[model samples]
Target chain A: MSNADHHLVAGAEGHQPSLAHHFSSHRQQYEAGKLGMWLFLLTEVLLFGGLFCAYAVFRANRPEIFIWAHQFLDKQLGALNTAVLITSSFTMALAVRCAQWDQRRLSAFFLTLTLVCACVFLGVKYVEYKHKWEEGLLWVRQFQPAEAAASLDESGTSDQQPRHAGIFFSIYFAMTGLHAVHVLAGMGAIGWVLVRTLRGHFNRQYFGPVDYVGLYWHLVDLIWIYLFPLFYLIH
Target chain B: MKPGPSSGTNLTHHNDQPFHAHVVPVIVLLAVFGALLGLTFLSLAATWIDLGTWNLWLAMGIATVKAALVALYFMHLRYDHSFYALVLAAALLFVLLFVCLTLLDTVEYYPDIHAIS
Candidate 1:
């Protein structure tokens, strides 16, 4: 338009390194980032979809077996763990919000809190799994649900062998194990984002990385929401 | 190839405002958590009555509700663009189709299915 206006536009166009060669502005970058994350989440659903199929088919074939197997689980522990994961997912969302506001300290703290809750979920899982394993409750060898039910304690697992209960544990371990793996991977990613946030890599305009990861973490939590009841609290 | 420049630079407001209104989302999250806990214990209680076959569907229904809550609020999907939710719904529909078909043909794969059924 004018001489000074032309120069100012030219200077701005030449300034920021974040500007893509083909892109006209920053808004496009954020939308593309959001789109790409959604695509990845689609694949994640398919991954869990496979396990859900197996679970459905098995439960259909052996309804009585599943019922017997479920009686052995501690529903109280499962509920507590569900609460832990839901809270962690909330903190993760807040961390993304904080990062968007350029609050590095609060963002880092929330991420750490999220990680702590994740560890607690894994810890509960470990205890539940380990107790099952020590009592010969794993799939393959000695999966005695009757013994497990009667035992209530570790030593009680010695009697009443229903080896076919392995089917339930197999399904349980497969679904929850895969979900746990995702949780571990998410923890690593969150830790990386926390490190980057501490270094001031995210501002209001460029917190896409943290935002994307937060979305991912919540998806993982969502999967667990389905899993906690399907496996542990099965009626 | 799709359009003009990239996505981020096109929008005038990059949503600088806080994500949620006051602590509304937090309150919602706690409410969801409490409900999930309630359903979980309810599932446990129902397990004892031998709902015959209803228990499985009942549990799955409760679990699906809990999953929806996490997806909507915890993932910010409720507050994000509508497109993400659409894509997720499509993926889930596909998964449902796949599960139903697989179960329908399940008898063919494992011949022993008849015996068990």
Candidate 2:
């Protein structure tokens, strides 16, 4: 029977089945897994949601500052990264599919592909971030920004307010930095699962680990989907 | 260690399939993937037109649609039990409630603050 049915059977027992240490019976484990994932997602939303709210707060206060900040960012790279992430999510789904169907080799291959896409994402981010870094745009409080803004042909001091631009960088780094951390964490988790998958540990019924990990990975993509338009497209 | 008839879910009836057991899921997945990409690009293009403040909302709406598709088909929430659906719906509702409450707090003073800008 499915782990699902095990849960049903356990419920039928006079004494709710003894949950295994990991889980008393399969029921407790599955419920726990789903609940845990949701709770984790809830926390993630609050974390990112806080930043989004901050964006709104600041944008409301200084629309011009936010607009000018968007101009300085490389929109093309941001859009490319968006496509890369969407593709990565697709590959991740494929990996889960492979696991669901018991295609070990194929699953491992897709997981590897997902990792490579993650790497490419980080690489592109590195380049964009390096450009920002060299331009003295990393948002150190004491630094002067008008001089840096002047160099960007159109950010003429008249329309630009670089000092206020500091807030944008602060938010940008905070948001994207946290996202990168999630990507790194995802890579580590996926690597572990991919290893297990290669060893033939999951089948259609047992693909929960891979399936859930894929869910987490998609959340990463979900955040980026919002981030792209908020930071790049909106302005 | 516990020798049971099956450790987890009931065994799949793979015996009937001669050589392969996955023609349908693959076809469905690919079709969904293509549609997802199409919708994503459509949303991106739509963003370029001026919809005023509503543009973001529109884009968010389209993106949400894409997300639902992925969650339903690509993620196989489609084939999963109704019980999982209830769990997910509850969690999503809770998230909505959380966002709404947060927004309520922030939106209260938005007008007063916007006047300063």
Candidate 3:
């Protein structure tokens, strides 16, 4: 009930070596770590929120550009990445659960699976980006839709390519590019957790690291949940 | 005190239990995962039907459901302390406010920008 009582209880039970000196008990430490992780995640939400706001403003002003630009995005590839990331999130969740259950081998397995899914997602992204680059469908200033530009020069008027089309690609690259970077960062975190799990560092009482990383990974998937429809599935 | 199921009280510290971590049941995890995938495909299918402005709204609505499922179950927010949810909700509220105010300003000045362009 009180901090003193918690310290007494922890001492009676034999203090967990993992428990930090500042905390009275393992639960206190766990809760503090979790709360800190959530607060960090909150900042992450606001960070991406700024980009989403910019997207909304641009999309509102020029609906035509979004409608026209979305066609260039490969819906099939986008859908694949969504499924992949969702699967990774599922594995990450399982890893945390396994760690909670003190099943180190299973937890490590799931983390490896999550890492694989992240790599697969990035592989698909590389393919998509490469195709766009080869076709010259890049962000503003570098945007030059190969066939559309040729037709525009010949006719002096091209409905196929709307004015300021570059703006659409600009937002596209910015949103997806940032999301991809997060995915890469997630892989690094997952890799570290996997190594820790293999080293037998986590058990039922000490899985805060896995849980925190799981939350971060889920946030990454959350961002893509919105990005997929906003960029790829737009009608 | 012996380690057992948490009594679902005491936010700060669980002094009564040896260890406390909500191990989500496998069935629940699978169910949430299935629902997430189902909603995703449903959103994709919704695109086939032409509803004009509603298409965007419908897609967004489905995505929001998926996001909620992830946050609630996968992230363990539902079983976790209320303060975590409160923190997330506050962040989302600010995002909504930020977007709305920015949009309002842009719409108000659109006429001038349109005339110039």
Question: What are the TM-scores, per candidate, against the unseen true structure?
Answer: 0.81, 0.78, 0.92
Can you tell me which runs of candidate 2 are displaced by over 4 Å? A1-32, A140-143, A153-158, B1-24, B82-117
RMSD of 3: 3.8
| Greater-TM-score candidate between 1 and 3 | 3
Best prediction by DockQ: 3
Residues A1-235 of candidate 1 have per-residue lDDT tens digits of: 3355435544555555554555443444555877899889999999899999998888776666676676556787887888788788878877876776778999999999999999999999999988888766777455654455666545653334343667988888888899999999999999999999988877655677888898899899888878877877665
**Would you list the rank order by TM-score, best first?**
3, 1, 2
TM-score of chain B of each: 0.68, 0.72, 0.85
* Worst-scoring 10-residue span by lDDT in model 2 chain A: A12-21
TM-score of chain B of 3: 0.85
- Cα lDDT tens digits for candidate 2, A72-105: 6777788778778878888898887777577889
Can you tell me the CAPRI class of model 3? medium
User: What is the per-residue lDDT of model 1 for residues B53-107, given as tens digits with 9 covering 90 to 100?
Assistant: 6777887787787778777776656656667788899889989998999988885
Model 2 error, position B84 (Å): 4.5
List the global CA lDDT of all models.
0.74, 0.70, 0.85
- Could you tell me how far off, in angstroms, the CA of residue A112 lies in candidate 1 after the best superposition? 0.6
**Interface RMSD after interface superposition, each candidate:** 4.4, 5.6, 3.4
